[model samples]
Target: MLIDKPLPELRRYRGRNPRPADFTRYWREALRELDATPVQPELVPNREIDVPGVECFDLWFTGVGGARVYAKYLRPKAPIGRRHPAVLQFHGYSGNSGDWLGKVPYVAAGFCVAALDCRGQGGRSTDAGAVQGNTLNGHIIRGLDDPDDRKLLFRSLYLDTVQLARVVMSRPEVNPDRLGAMGASQGGGLTLACAALEPRIRRAAPVYPFLCDYQRVWEMDLAKDAYAELRDYFRRFDPCHEREADVFRKLGYIDCQHLAPMIKGEILMYTGLMDQICPPSTQFAAYNHIRARKEMVLYPDFGHEWLPGEADRTLRFMLPLAR
Candidate 1:
């Protein structure tokens, strides 16, 4: 089923959401706040997960709004007096970073790996939320009622990605110039955000990313799954569509599509055309805006879930950072 525009049209789709007039300035100020925020990073060794050649730790750092962000860090136990490349991983929406064993292969291949557990999700990271509105299902709608756009939950989450990279780069044994990021779904959105915010990120791989063009997703009526909260928010709060324009305008501040042009890293994005969850065009809306060296892998037969061999392909694509 063709869920979006044909591939050719998808290539040219800029996005349906309007970019706020102060979009650039808004992000600059947000980044400035991150710059001023002190990330008191702490790394505690996880003795139970250690292997002969790999070391694991529970990584924590202070993020925007003073949230204590969490991640799983792994590195080669014995580096041969040389710096190693690093990879940042973000998990799907509402999910924690997976077990330490999942990150071993990268460490085995001589790269330091850090996987983030998004704040307030099913993880150790602190949300530190003080929003004015709905505290329900969606992070998308969180703090929408606040007069301050900076209070948006995803804004803080996006900043957390950059904070994690900053923390990772500060390590003595990691190569600052060879950093990469990867994730699927919400994590994929974050991968793009992280690379866009931190231009030093050398590469990024985002598979079927969520949180792109919010209005487009609503128009396509694909807002019932991972985006169910978008629909729910409307049903309960604005049943007459009286606040439609205002709502989307607020969401524009955190949209990944708006952030794509700022990315300098080489991007390898994956999309499944049959995807009903995030929808294919929503993914392309962000991808088409990326001006850096980029490529897309299309799965005409797949959806938002598994696209076979994607894990191996991503591993190979990012492995070059270690070179």
Candidate 2:
């Protein structure tokens, strides 16, 4: 049973969510603030996951608000004269940078890999937690009640992605022109955000991205799982939906759909029509706004979980850039 619009309609779907009038200006100012912040980066060698051809290091950098960010960095051991491409990875919501072994393939493919541990999640990265609202279920609602949009948790998280890109691009062994990004679900959303905020990202692969079309998800009554916090916030704070417009408007500050138009990188989105956790329509809401060279791999019967060979395909999609 498909849970969203059919493929034909999905192609033409423009989404029902409202894009804030000052969306572009808001992000421009945010990035300006992020750029002004001092990113004092540090790298320490890690022996636990060392392998044959890749050097593993614990990467730390200061992000916006002075919170420290963490990432697992693997630089490939190529000839001294050779410069390698790099990939920045974002993980699913509430998750950390995955085990070191998972990044080996990219390292073996002559790519330096840096997987981020998002702020306040299941990773070593720190969450400053100075918001004004319910900090209960999800990061989406962390600063919803704050008078200032700068206090939003996702604002900092999104800026963290940009800072990591800057860090990776600064490496002497890496080619800044060949940097790419990959992630699924929340990571997928961050992938979009990173590419949008960091124009240097040349390629992006986002699988079933979350944090898009929040109003559409709410109207469809599908805000239960990863979006459960959205529903819970309303139930507890605005029981009668008095300030609904303001709530969604505030969320616009972090919505990936609004950010999509800023992405200049080539995009390849992986989506399953049956993905209830992040519905197909919601995924398309962001995809439709992408003005870059882009394509989508549709899984007609798949859900939010793994799609067979998706990893292989993504690797192949990025493989051409190695040359």
In order, candidate lDDTs are 0.90, 0.90
Q: In model 1, which regions exceed 4 Å deviation? A: 130-136
Please report, as a residue range, the 10-residue window in candidate 2 with the lowest summed lDDT. 128-137
Clashing pairs in 1: none
Error of 1 at 129 (Å): 2.5
lDDT of 2 by residue, 231-319 (tens): 99999999999999989988888889889999999999999888999989888989999999999999988999999989999999898
Instruction: Look at candidate 2 and tell me the lDDT of residue 191.
Output: 99
Task: Assess candidate 1 and give its lDDT.
Answer: 0.90
Q: Can you write out model 1's per-residue Cα lDDT over 1-323, one digit (the tens) per residue?
A: 57789889998998998888899999999999999999999999888764889988999899988878889999997746679999999999878899889889899888999999888888888875733222336788988888987888899999999999999998988999999999999999999999999999999999999999999999998888788988999898999999899899999998999999999999999999999988888899999999999999989999988899999999999988888
